[model samples]
Target: MGGKHSVLGNSTLNQSPTIENIQAAYKEGDTSRAQELIKISCGENNRLRLEKHQLLSVAAGNGDLEAVQYLLKEGRVDLPREPTDENPAVVAAYYGHEDVVKELLDSLPGTNWIGLRRLQELDVSDNRLTEVPACFLHCFKSLRSFNVSRNKLKVFPDPWACPLVASLIEFPGFLSECLEVLFLNDNQLEAVPQSVCCLKSLNELYLSHNPGIRELPPELGQLSNLWQLDIEELNIGNIPAEVRKEGPSAVLAFLRAHLRKAEKCKLLKMIIVGPPRQGKSALLEALQTGKVPQMMQNETSIRTTKWELEKPSGVKDKMDSVEFNVWVIGGPASMSTVNQCFFTDKALYVVIWNLALGEEAVANLQSWLLNIEARAPNAAVVVVGTHLDLIDSKFRTERIATLRAYVLSVCRSPSGTRATGYPDITCKHLHEVSCKTLEGFDGLRRLLFQVSCNIKDMSNAATSQKLVGRLIPKSYLLLQAAVLAERLRRDLEDEVQYLTDLQLEQIIEQNPDSDIKDYEDLQTD
Candidate 1:
C-alpha cells in the first residue's frame, strides 16, 4: 500500500494539465490561491492557458457572463476569432442571453466590433420581429448578406426608409456603398420602399412568401444590375403587356396570374418523360410565351380537364361549329386508362410523344407506328419529341437522322406509289421545338390540321363497327352536365342577390323623409 503510486504522482511525467495548485487551494476550501491562480493563468501565457480554451468557451457557453467578460478583457482570448466550438455570439443569441450579448457588444472596441451584423446570419428563424432595431441599421449599412426569411415582419424596417443615415453619424462611412444580397421572404411586406432600388451594387433579392404584397413599384426596373429576384409567393394577380408602362408590381402580378393559369394548364401538353424535373413544364411555358411563374406545376397524381382548350380539336372548330363536341386524349404517364372518351372508331389523330429524346426515340417511333396501324389504321399518326430543345445540337442532329431512318423503315409507301413495282412507306418528320421560344409551333399546327382533315372524311359505316364497341351515344352528356351545374350556380346567386336587393330596398323605404320648407317662406319672412 505504501509503495503504490497515485494518479496525481504521474501528472508531471506527461505535460498534462493537473491544476494541482488551484485544486489544492479549492480542496482546502481556501479561496485566496484559487483567485490568484485564475488571475495569473488568465493574464497572458500561463502554461495551461491554451489547453483550457475549450473550458473557457464552455464558461461562456454556460452564460457565465462575468467569466466571459474576464477572458475577453484579459486579452488572452481573441473576441472575434472565427467562432469555433459553437460561436459564442450564436450560442448567446440562440439561448436568449441578451444581456451577455449586450455586454459583449459594449466591450468590443468601436473600431473592431461589428454589432448587429453578427445577428444577420445567426439562425433566429421563426422569431417574430415587428420592427427592425435602430442598431441593425448600422448593421444593414455594413451588411453584405442577410437572411430574415420565415420571420414575421409586417412592414419594412423604418431604417430602410433612409439608408443608414442615423448609423453613419456614429461610425462615419462604416457602411460604404457595397451591399449585395437581402432576403425578406416569408414576411408580410405589402410594399418595399424605393430606397432599396438605390443599392446599385445589389445583385440578388429574395422577396418570396409575402402573400399580402399586392403591387411592385415601377422603379424596380431601375435595378439593372440585379441578377436573381425571387418573388415566388407574393400575391401578384396579373401580367401587363408593358413592364415600364404598367409598373413592375403590375408586371409581376400579371406574371403570377399567367403562371397560375397557363403554366400548369392542360394546354401546355407537358407529358414529363424524363428521369424527373428537368424544367419540362418551365421549358413549355417559356416557349409558349417568355416568362413563367413558380406556381405552375402539376402537383397531383390525376388531373382531368373538361375545358375548351384541353382538347385542341375543339378550339380550331369553335369558329365553324355551331354545336360541336371535341376532346383530346393526353396527360401524365400515369394515365394508363385508355382514352375511351375521345376514341370511338379508334384514334383519329394519335400524338406519339417521345419524351426521353434518348436513343430509344427510334424504338418509340416504331412502337407508335405499330400502335397506329393496329389500333386505328386510318388515323394520322404523328410522332413528336416534346423536349427536343433540351438535347445538344450535335446529338439532336444525329438523333433526327436516326429517327427519320427508323420511321421510314416502319411506314409503308402510299398504295399507288411504287419503287420498281414494289410498295414503300413514306414518312414525314419534324424536330427542334421549344416551349420557351414558340419555335416549331407552326409545324405542330400544320400537322394537327392534316390529321383532323383526314379523319373528317372517313365514312360513318367504316367507323361504325369500332364505335359500337363503346357507344353510349352521349355526345351532349358532358355539355349538359356542365350547363346544368353552371345554371344551378347562377340561379342560386341570382336568387340570393334578388333577396338582398329587396331587403336593401325595404331599409331605404323605411327611412324618414323631411318636408321641404322653401325659398318662398324666407322671402315672406
Candidate 2:
C-alpha cells in the first residue's frame, strides 16, 4: 500500500523475492515493499534460502505480524552463534511497528516454542528498552548469551536474583554455568553487579559507556575465565591512569586491591516526637523527605525514614554532608518507652505540637520533653507548632509569641528529675508551621542543618577511629549491598520484625561477599 516504489522498481508486485532481492530488501531496512516481497516469496517457497530465525527477524522488522505468527508456530528458534543486526521483535518495537510487537508480546507466555531445557541466545543490542523485555525473563532457563546493550536498562538481568521472578525459575543457577559472554555496554547501570561474578564460565563482558558506573564490584577479580572485560568510557573517578592504560586484565586484577576494610557514612538519627493527629506525619514528610508509610489499620505505632541532608555551601569544611535516619514516632501508641528504642544522644529530636489544642498543646509538649530527657537528655531538640494556617489573623502573632516564650524557658534547662548520667534537657529552637500550606519549612530546614553541624556521636569521638571514609568498605558497596539484600529477603518473606543481635552479626560476618575475606578484620563503630 506504500506506493509502488519497490526496491526492484517496475517489477511486478506478485513476483517472488530471489535470494539477492531479499538481501537488497534487508539493506534498505523495513518497508511495505519488503513485506510484499516476503509474502510472495513465502507463498512460493515453503523453505526459504535463509534460516527461519533470520526470516522471522526480517519479517517482524517489515511489520508483517502474520508472517511472524506463522513462522513462530514451528518448534524452537535458537539464535545462531554469529551476531545479527536485525533484532527479531525488538526491531519491530524500535521502529514503532506496533502490530508486530503486540503479536510477539501477546504470544510470549503460551507459545511453548522455546523449551525450558534448551539453551537459546539473543542479541538485542540497540533497542531503546528501558527495561529487559518480558522475553528475557520468560526465556530465563533457555538463554545462553543474552545481550541487551546500548539501551536504557539500569538494572542487571539475573532472573534468579530478582524475588518476583525467582519463584518462576525452578532452578536459579541455570545461567551461571551456561552463559559465556554478556554485552551490557552503553547503558545506565549505576554499579557493577557482584552477581555477575557468579557466572564462573563467563569469558567476554562489555561494560563500557555506562557513565553511572561509580564503583566496580570487588569480587570481579574472582571471575577465573574472564579474558575480555571492557570498562572503556566509564565515569569512575578513583581508577588510576596506569591501571586504565594497562587494559582490561590489569583493571580486573585491581578490583581486589580496591576492597575496603572499613566504611563510614556521616549519618544521624533524627527522631520526630509528637502526639497522634498533630500533623507529625505531614511535617515529617515535608521536612526530611522520608515518606511516612501508610500503616495497617490495626497496627499504628512507629515509622522510620532515611533522609539525606546535603550540607549547605560555605558551611565549615571538615563536615560536608550527612544522612538523617528520621524516626517518626507519633500516634497514641509510640509515646510510650516500649515504642521508642530509637532514642540516642547523637540524634536531633524534632518535637511537634498541634496548635488546635491551645493550653493542652503545651502540656503535650512538656510530656514529650520529659521522655527526651529521660532517654537522650543531651540530644539537640527543636520544638515545632503545626496548624499555623488555621489560626485567626489577629490571634496568630500572640499564639506564636507565647509558644516561643515557653520554648525559651525550656531552653534554660529547668530543674527536673535528675538522672545520674543524663544531662539537663534543653530546646535549642522553637518554630511554627502549617504542613498543609508548607509555611516556615525553609526556616525549619535551616535550623535542622545548624543543629546537625555541631552535634557529634559520642562513641565516634572517644575512639581513635581513622578511616571514616572506609568504615562500610568504599571501593565496592558490596557490604551495604549484602545488608540491603538481607532486608529485601526479609521483606519478601514478610519477616518485617527486627532481627536478633546474633542473626545480624552472622549476616555481617558471613556477608556472602567473597571480596570481604569472611570479614575477619571486622570492627564496630
- Deviation from native of the Cα of residue 213 in model 1, angstroms: 3.7
Steric clash pairs (candidate 2): 262-470, 262-471, 262-473, 263-470, 263-471, 263-472, 263-473, 264-471, 264-472
Error of 2 at 398 (Å): 3.6
TM-score of each: 0.32, 0.42
lDDT of 1 at 491: 86
For all candidates in order, the CA lDDT equals: 0.44, 0.62
Model 1 spans with C-alpha error above 4 angstroms: 1-78, 81-85, 93-99, 114-143, 154-158, 161-176, 188-195, 236-525
Q: Candidate 1: worst 10 consecutive residues by lDDT?
A: 514-523
Candidate 2 lDDT over 2-112, as tens digits, reads 221232233322333453466476567644566565556556546544545556665665566766776666424433322223445545645445567656656665543
lDDT of 2 at 183: 90
On TM-score, the candidate that comes out on top is 2
Per-residue lDDT tens digits for candidate 1, residues 29-118, read: 565555466566665454564534533333443455765666677745655534332445444543345556556555556734454444
